[model samples]
Target: MSPVSPLLELDGAVQADGLDAGVAAHYGNPMIEQRRLLAGEAVVDLSNRGVLGVAGPDRLTWLNSISSQELRSLAPGQSAETLLLDPNGRIEYAMDVIDDGVETWLILEAGELPGLHTWLDKMRFTLRVQVVDHSLAYAVIGTMAVDPAAVHLAPAAPNGVALTWRDPWSSVGNGGFQYADAPAHPAADWHWTEALVLRDRLPALRDAVRAGTVSAAGTLALEALRIAAWRPRRATEVDEKTLPHELDWLRSAVHLNKGCYRGQETVAKVHNLGHPPRRLVLLHLDGSDAVLPVHGDEVEATKQLADGETERRGVGVITSSARHHELGPIALAVIKRTVPADITLHVQSQGISVAAAQEVIVPQSAGSVAEIPRLPRLGIRTPGH
Candidate 1:
């Protein structure tokens, strides 16, 4: 279990449960906190998020060779996202990366640090790279503000470059792909960032919140905004078989043209000759029930049988669900790639069926973007012949 954040001692702070345990979920009122967060008037206590440091001259090159993103040319203070995938092209770890001239900082889920650090350490054989877990020394603070300075939190700058990682999900990165096809992507306005601060600064931040000099929101408000922006979080969206294309993660975390890596073959094949087995969708749940569906809840679709009867079949499971300020009860789910986009789905939550309308994110025709022409089959007649 992770250490509980000291901010929980603040008045009205509620400790979050489950994956977000040890951090504040909300500060007594969630709805108002969401508004403040959206207005850039609040900062989220993400002290539980993991922080890792990779120092050495070969940090960028070494990282680029292993991850899905092309990080070899990352300049100091430039933010990028990358994914470490299994040989089968399934996402295993996602990282928010930033180089600070002297070291490369990786921010990820707290529970994922142990595995990622171990894997990175093993891969550093004979390399000039040094992997160090800094989770105990530093804490992460999240905000939707365009700049961290707005929240009065000074990011650590050990190398003269602030250790802040701005999210790259707002646009399709170079050598990346966007499968969502939304002319106006909701992420276009997603100005999210995470700033690493010294762990000892938590008390000062808490005092700032108490003095009302800095407003503090919780993880719940941040989660709601993240869902509305169609951002896929590694903690909730990734499973054993999750592919980057399934979550439309290629828009930011993958470089389709990068050099060979662990999952390069599968990534190339899926993009050029095949399609992802599943696609992500946004679900607008019926808020009338006032029963919000939690993660792992079954998402079912009604099918008309040949016998003229209807049956509810499990199509997918809700990965992350939240009550957005404007969108109301919304969730992100991964359904079959062949599932019809117009179909109405139901979420089985606490024994009650909640009707959900599908908002297509990754379309059924998500992959096979390469325009390779077919060759004539052997022993088959050709028109010219």
Candidate 2:
């Protein structure tokens, strides 16, 4: 009989079937399949991101007044999405704001710390909110080992629907309900912890994933899964030039009835009356083998001409793309309304062809404000003049 293998052996049982070969090459991670499967079956660690703690007497109210979400309505232990927008209503950051009651925590992209913290500090004022950086205190997310006991776990109280226990792998940085402000519990005693993981411990988790004690995943697979889930990412989908409404942020972030905030008027106008200059659309590539186009790739929609003229100049652009075993090559693009959905667009750099599909496709009538009309050119020129 063979000696017992270490439970967290570095090279163990790995279900490597989910990752398609072409997808793996494009993503540089052949281990994505294991990660996806593990996400469904266990808990996965993703504590690399940063966490910010906001607490005080007026914390929720203060946050509600400043951000793009209805912070006041968030129940104790519930997590919600919020956006920090520039004065012109462009998205600066998109974050998950979780209310642990005593302190509402902000889980943000790792790269967003400097700008986000600065912005929050600038906004700090007469309000009693205190913002603390908790990135190094507690491990934000850790190895997801499937707990048989967690299966059939009932929804926790107070947070109600907001607190569903999944495998925990799927809920990475996803807010968990904390029973804060309960009749028996006071908000003062609560202190949220965010951990900075040591680089050395990563191997143990990876080994667990490989040995079937846990599952291993790479960034590529995680992103592909996120796309399938239709969760918008900050740096990718929501960025400097992006308006909150155009990214479907209103569904999770903005409150239609909330009082004034810095960019509220523009947000409201865009949501109520104006049509965004562009609409967000999903692209499903026909060829699975094609490398998913890189971000910022131009999408050219060619119109067939009777006179054999060349295809018209591109009217769309690709924002992001990822390889999904289930969906093959997929992307999110912003295109001019004139570009019809039936038209096949070539991803300019790779020459890969893809057709646009509606994930949450909304037309002009879908409550988005139409683009504000441009004023006539002051120095309009004519060839004759």
Q: Of the candidates shown, which would achieve the greatest TM-score relative to the real structure?
A: 1
TM-scores of all predicted structures: 0.97, 0.70
* Model 2 clashing-pair count: 12
Per-model C-alpha lDDT, please? 0.92, 0.55
Worst 10 residues of 1 by lDDT: 1-10
Error of 1 at 24 (Å): 0.4
* Residue 335 alpha-carbon offset, candidate 2, angstroms: 2.0
Candidate 2: worst-modelled 10 consecutive residues by lDDT: 18-27
The per-prediction tally of clashing pairs is: 0, 12
lDDT at position 264, candidate 2? 80
Tens-place lDDT digits, model 2, residues 1-385? 1111122233423221222111111113434543543344433344445667787879888888878777786676555677777788888887766675677777777678777888888888878888887665422332223432131112222323232222111222222221111233211221112222333444454555555654444445555655554445676775457775564556546666767877888887876677566666677765644566767888777777889877757776777677777677778776765566555667666665554454434343434434658898779778998
Report the C-alpha lDDT of model 1 over 50-74, residue by residue, as the tens digit: 9999999999999999999999999
